[model samples]
Target: MIIFRPPKYDAIDHEKNLKESDGLKFATEIYKGQRSLSAIVEFVLSRIKNYVKKLHNFDQINKYIQGRTKTNKSKILLLTDKNKPTPLIKSIAIDYLSSFETAYITIKKNEKDEIFDFFKIDKDIAKLPQIIIIDTKDNPNEKEEIIVYDGDLNKVALSHYLSNFATPLEGPASKRMDLLNKHKNINNSQNNKKDKNKKKKNSKNTANAHDEL
Candidate 1:
């Protein structure tokens, strides 16, 4: 889920914000955020592409869905502060519909929307650099879990949070191996130092005994 405030005619600040977060992956903004809605759609597509690259089981999840005779796609929800659908917004919506199973909501100024209530978000959250709510349901019996992230887009935080739901195939094993190797090296170094100290002490004791004799 992605929620953002609509940029004004001069969207330089927004563009800069996106750039800072690496969110402008494939967006072509001729003049800052002055690009057409098509460009915005392209930017979103790029985000999805980046997501797939980072997510280990994204393809596997799609395959599972396909095997179950279901459409294999992500459910993306885009919320924007736009009262009317401009040409760019409309085109962006169309692109989203075609690419992913997407739903969008246009929020009017000062209009009370139910989505905010559902997400338990307020004006403060909307004012942030970005807001995304991730919902995961890993088991049939387990209650749905929601993770909310506000402020700038943090890929590391997002990855770590999502790992609680589904871990990467090799991530745990590689981490364990690294820890084991570190400990093994530390132990070997300590033992070598201890052996050297023991030999030095024995030699010193023998010298003292010979002198006394």
Candidate 2:
């Protein structure tokens, strides 16, 4: 059976460096070729053209949906159920969604700040995306946020920014929990064995003392 090994710290560092180098190359490519307003406009137009062309195939949309299948890709933020979402919280959530090209939100049936609450304001968002609110009670107070993007240009964003959050841990967090559980089981087993041995020893001593008497 093949086992998967996570990337080492050095490997992660190298990967980051490579990404930075690639970003610099892209910046250089744009800046080097006519660093004028017209050039910038032309670049933007080219990107739009590419985007429109890709929409016909719908590959990007499908890929984004598939990538978001997991909760991690969902990028949730769990929080305690509160009476209401503060103005500050609403602004922050909206701001995060604005950073993306498209954004959607699903609210529980009785959520304080349902999607209807934000529909009027969504027009102000440059993306002018759709928001969906699902009414599932089992999810209860769990809040979730999903952000999708290849890099800086966000493609899709979805959030169920409830008064709560939920996610399965990986990396160090998962490892620590596993170790704690293992230690607990081992300690319980050892204690049971020690108790058994102690009883056996005591029984042998009692028998020997009785024989001597």
Instruction: Extract clashing residue pairs from model 1.
Output: none
What is candidate 2's lDDT per residue for 137-157, written digit by digit as tens? 234355433331212222112
State the lDDT of candidate 1 residue by residue for 1-213, as single tens digits. Answer: 242433222111335554566443333334344358876675654433211111122243233223311223233333456433233323323333322232334444553334455556675536422233334243434443333455233444433443443432222223554687799999999999999999999999999999999
Find the 10 residues in a row with the least total lDDT in model 1: 49-58
Off by over 4 Å in 2: 1-72, 77-173
Q: Please report, in order, the local distance difference test score of every candidate based on alpha carbons.
A: 0.41, 0.34
- Give the clashing residue pairs of candidate 2, or none: 78-164, 78-165, 79-164, 79-165, 143-164
* TM-score against native, each model: 0.31, 0.29
Model 1 residue 13 CA deviation (Å) reads 40
